[model samples]
Target chain A: MTARTGVAGFLGRVTAMIVKEYIQLTRDRVTFATMIMIPLLQLVLFGYAINTTPRHLPTAVFSHENSDVSRAILAALRNTAFFSFVREAQSVEEAEHLVRAGEVLFFVEIPAGFERSLRRGDRPQILVAADATDPVGTGNALAALSGVVASALVRERFVGAIAEEAQGREATSQDAFEIVQHRRYNPAGTSQLNIVPGLLGTILTMTMLIFTALSVTREIERGTMESLLAMPIHPVEIMLGKIVPYVMVGILQAVLILGAGIILFAVPVEGSVAVLSAATLLFITANLSIGYTFSTLAQNQLQAVQMSFMFFLPSILLSGFMFPFSGMPQWAQWIGEGLPLTHYLRMVRGILLKGSGLSDLVRDGAALFGLMLLAMGIAVARFRQTLD
Target chain B: MSERAAAPAGTGERSAADVAIAVEGLSKRFGANLVVDDLTMTVRRGQIYGFLGPNGSGKTTTIRMLCGLLTPDAGRGTCLGMDILTQGREIRAHVGYMTQRFSLYQDLSVKENLEFVARLYGVPKPEAAAQAALERLGLKGRGRQLAGELSGGWKQRLALGACILPGPDLLLLDEPTAGVDPQARREFWAQIHALAAEGLTVLVSTHYMDEAERCHEIAYIAYGRLLAQGTVANVIAASGLHTYTVDVKGEGPREASQRITDLSQKLSAALGVDMVAPFGTSLHISGRDAAALEAAIAPFRGEPHLVWRKDEPTLEDVFIDLMRGKDARR
Candidate 1:
């Protein structure tokens, strides 16, 4: 053939492949919708849902003194948009229970003589308790407490008293009702400390799910699975072999992201490196196995991608990476719990932020380990082992 | 290993033989549709068995059954002297199935594809084996070239290389030369014959007649049923088709060609004519009923420009006749 014919022939074959791919993509309605609709959904949904300066955080009050001054103080706290008192705790113990159960973000305590002291010019303290497990959630709320308190005293009687007793108190910290605020587990509310650890789960979940899902389905779509099935290799062997490479990829991605997190974000790793590594490995395997299960279920690479994105949608949106897990409604929390990311997020945050060890994270570790088994079991069971 | 020694574990009740594959009453049904129905066939060791069929005729389904890639819903078979039902993995170990499409990793280099397959089959000294395969398949200097970058013919060669890299006893090729050029197809057959000479049994499916003729034995199937089997001459002779070559030379060459084209259409639908196929410049009119076909074409025989002569039926003619007869019965 002439060079002209060769060039034309090359173009002809190239165009045919391109055209075939376009036609396949357009013909598959689910895949087409997933390609177009998912990113848009993620953008709009995550844009509104992820709030770092989370307002209307559930706060409860326990005041031994029920007077106008204390009421004004609580009302001012509400007005600051930092706290919304949804419950009235009868005692400080009840408020602590609310915080531990994740029912409230902040708990307030007013001594019985608080209102009387404000009137009589005797300074009495009021205590504020904040749930700081997810330190990012309550950081801003805690910072707004003093402002909420100082403005509350600006009401009619306290203002006149402060002006009258200028010599006694130019409002030296002694005269004001001292708002003792407790910044929870992560007192400094380090953003990197929060995000870097979460990256271990988020990055693994994203890459692991998409990689293994696409890899297996791609073999089927490329016609290689038929040859693979005809070979002597067992289905279990294929599954594990397909998994190990992506697991390595996942590990590499984790290391890179974690490195970036530590350097750029200054995220701290407080817990044992070995614990974090083991949990992360388990989490990566879980995501990959789930992806492999999806690969077995899906007919083509596009369908596999769609399945991964479907899993990713809930994971990114509700897995407590982008939003506080406890802040979401009970149903969303339940859904998040069912996802492996939820448990991994808790473990990473616990281990890296709270300095939690293996014993401290046994529940989340077990949940993650259990999820890996279930996903892997389903993947092996669903493997057809034949073209049929 | 001898036949008995080569026999796979768990099947001591049956005697071993030269047959690489043997099946009885094989049937497979996909949901409500039966794909392969009560198919009984045997392929002798160390021979090229040509499998021919129209599309959707269960050619692939049958090949799958032979290699242990599929299990027939109702059948008993042994591949390489191992029970296919109980020893699918054992059967798969000794069989190489080349799919209709190029199935090796396109991203991998030629050498890598060979090495991967070699490793998967646990071939001894994989690097040496892959190198030998590369050299044997004329892929010596192009070992580093990506398999995807090769032309259709080269891709086919590479796929064929992967199939034989493991030293499989039986190679099941599904339309291995479907889109390859004539020269490439010829070379592919040469390699296949060479392998068969070394006692590697092959069951290959194809659409081309010349390739079918190259096979030592052939089987024709259509719509999940086997219609004919045996050597090339045996299949054609058993077809019972009487073919007549019609040559027309009218006033001008163009006019004669046009006349032949027009006659082809009419003769295709003529009463008692099974098929009227254009064979190059001539037309082959064939039917199962010799007397009826001769009487049907007798009127045209008297035309001075036309010469009618009896001809041996081609494999194409036999397959065409088999397909038509099968369709008519349905």
Candidate 2:
């Protein structure tokens, strides 16, 4: 029954608006896709993929000892499942090179006299070197090595002496084997040490993309771009003029964030400030160019914002911000390698945590710069000087 | 021979110095519809030329082509003594285009908007030029206010001020005063005429008959085709419309005005009375031929309640006739 007045009419009007909104929402495929797909995609990708205690870390064993005890230790380390021995290093120098090149996460060196030390009960040291540039990547692996050592001597060959010493209140043979861990890069395994550097790239990426993506679209939305195109300005000049100011905004945000990170988190800038500044400039410009490209492609402000977030989603998840870069699958990592943020995060972490100089960041930094040039080229090409 | 070389605006013939904007065989098509079709037109120096057309009749597209803001799909022209196709950038430097909408940044202050435009045009002493534009346009003491906060009339004047700040030789104003009050429109036209008197060629597009009448020369276009172009008297004469003014009397002032409206409605459906519009205390009836119009109104001629005499057709009659004629063609 309908009393087609007052409250009923109001309800009818509200329902009318609701029906209109649903119709409009369904018409825009991009918005509809974003509404349905983004949440489900992020949930499935991040839910099963993010593992805090990352295992199967590529490890290398360096050994001069061929004793039964050394073999037992290597077998114990392999049985832990956290470390996978991919190669046998010829020497310590070779092992260090493997870690430096990011080929392996942990290097284990079983020193000489491992069998003699076990027989004499003289605690022989086992050195486990780690690549601590990503503290999250190596912390759990380093802490779990003690369990490897305890189970390393569980065989009947050394149990009688270990049992006799245990009865006499002397040190067991397991105690006689010592494991020394050297956390390289970020030795203390601090989260801030890892996060503060990544924050620089992430913050710049979010702000630069949004600020520039809205600028050109804003001019068009307000009907100012037609007059702008009618003037004697080139497309390159228009892109640059719209972009350079936002570049300054990105820099200002960078300076504030970096200063706060230094003061509040005590995350040390181990490398030269000048080198960090250069990489930051290149990274900020790259993101701004990408945002400008989106502005040229988007017809309206809503589409511009949607485009920005679609790019932002991949950047936040796959750029090694929330998860360890090496922990992700090969396909995910391949996609990460293509994003500017991935390269920028590496370059920033290299400079701040790893004490990387300009020469040290040449590979990732150059990739970031090349991305900026490509984005700038696309933006200039897509930016039409006339409405036609 | 190519339409380029054969048309009057062709470089092979007249020089670009005399014409502020000249385009020959201009045509533009969007998908299947011809928004502008093989239209040729020219405007001389220091003249205020009016473009009158219905909406979607390609007035803005033609204006943009002349100013080099748009490239015609098929055409050749020159603006400011430079080829509109190849030398668009050079032409843009010399032409000031005021858009149909209020396009200047509304968030910016009035003076700031003027200054930004001045800078874009590379005007020397930009600050002084902006200040002078503000004072000249009667925007003094309001430089700090946001442009969006200004009334429609003030916004119109500020837009004009911004256009003239660059000192361009040719100005293309697309409906400068569409919604402005009559007083403000009068002032705006007066200022535009003053600017034209100083050797600045002006091309304005409008729908108002009074505004069209203010132009030195008026061009009427309908449905992407040029219908008529001439002085107001010439256009009216060229329409071949014989008109009659029928005044009503023997009634009170209000009653007489109402009677005039009734009479206009009565004669509106007559065979030869093509247009019947109320004017003050009388009705103006117009048709294509004198004999047909007289024969149509002869039944009302002997009525004691009405008096009639021959009159000239109005500018509005000619334009509406031209519009209706185009509509009837298809």
> What DockQ, on C-alphas, does every prediction get?
0.22, 0.17
Q: Against the hidden reference, what TM-scores do the models get? A: 0.76, 0.76
lDDT per residue as tens, model 2, A1-388: 1113344333333333233223333444674454334333433343335444577899999998888788888887777677899989999999999999999999999989877876676656789999998786776677657544644575536645663453333223332322222235643334566666766777678777876787789889999888877777667666766666556566767776677667766777888999989888889889989999999999998999899999988898999987768779999999998789999888888888778887888999888888889988999899977777
User: For candidate 1 chain A, which ten residues in a row score worst on lDDT?
Assistant: A174-183
For residues B157-259, what per-residue lDDT tens digits would candidate 1 score against the true structure?
9999998887888999999998899999989998998898899999999989888888888888888988888878777778899999987754577877788
Model 1 DockQ (Cα-based):
0.22
lDDT by residue (A1-388, candidate 1, tens digit) is 0111244433432332233233333445675455334333433343335445677899989999888888888888888777889999998889999999989988999998886676666656779888888777786677657645655676535656552463235335532322222135544434445655665676677767876787668878888789888876656666776676556556666676666666655667889989988988889889989999999999888999899999998998899887767679999999998899999998888877678898999999899889899998999899988766
* TM-score of chain A by itself in each prediction: 0.60, 0.58
- Report the lDDT of model 1 for residue A304: 92
> In model 2, which runs have C-alpha deviations exceeding 4 angstroms?
A1-182, B1-15, B253-258
Clashing pairs in model 1, backbone N/Cα/C closer than 3 A:
none
